[model samples]
Target: MNILKKVILIDDDQINNFVCESIIKNERFAEEVQSFEWAENALDYLKNTAVQQPEAFPDLIFLDINMPGMDGWSFIEEYKQIPEEVTKNCCLFMLSSAVDRKDIISAKSLKEVKDFFSKPLSPEILSFIKEEFICS
Candidate 1:
């Protein structure tokens, strides 16, 4: 498998982040994994790293839709303001526990969001993602 350089998990649930990080590491899906409880913090990291060290920017991002401060939707809005060169290579996916059909439709409609998946990253899903998005 082609391991990604970095991946970011933006979700309020610490347990979910821990589980997802473990799964990513065990699967060797990414060399580095960073988890953020706040979407704003993740955005700040992206903004700073994208400008200072583009290579340090995450190759993939798993964003949750129901964060306390800034939800995934708001994060996408802010993300759009970042430079295209910095974000062009980065793949963003919505990883939320929300079962709302509208949420899925809304996420899929966004240009930035590559795909949507339910909470808790699994090895199977990661494999599919690696094959379909990263390796392709």
Candidate 2:
């Protein structure tokens, strides 16, 4: 099933971004995938793209919780201010290696986050998300 037309990966780790991007492409999860090493850049891109070209907004976003400038949590705080047109249709998922319960609880408490997942996104989890959230 076609779940996403575009997907974005916001992670500080270049290797993780590469792997995630490859996975999304190889699994045909999205027609386009954009990876960013900085959350600030991704935020700027999202806001600008929404105004300049709303059609380019991603349908799905995988955000890492650990980063230098703006962490995943901070990104969400700022992201909430963006126009609804830019975020309404996008599904936000927190991607991190942190297993802290507080983090998971915090993630779930946020309305913007659809769900939380451990790092190294897998096909099984991807399929599950697509089936549970996107396909349904």
lDDT of 1 by residue, 22-115 (tens): 9999998888999999999999999999899987778999999998989999999999999989899999999999999999999999999999
Candidate 1 lDDT score at position 82: 90
Off by over 4 Å in 2: none
**Which residue pairs overlap in candidate 1's backbone?**
none
The list of candidate 1 runs beyond 4 A from truth reads none
Which pairs in model 2 have colliding backbones?
A: none
Lowest summed-lDDT stretch of 10 residues in model 1?
1-10
Superposing all C-alpha atoms, what RMSD in Å does each candidate have to the true structure? 0.9, 1.1
State the local distance difference test value for candidate 1.
Answer: 0.93
Quantify all predictions' global Cα lDDT against the true fold. 0.93, 0.91
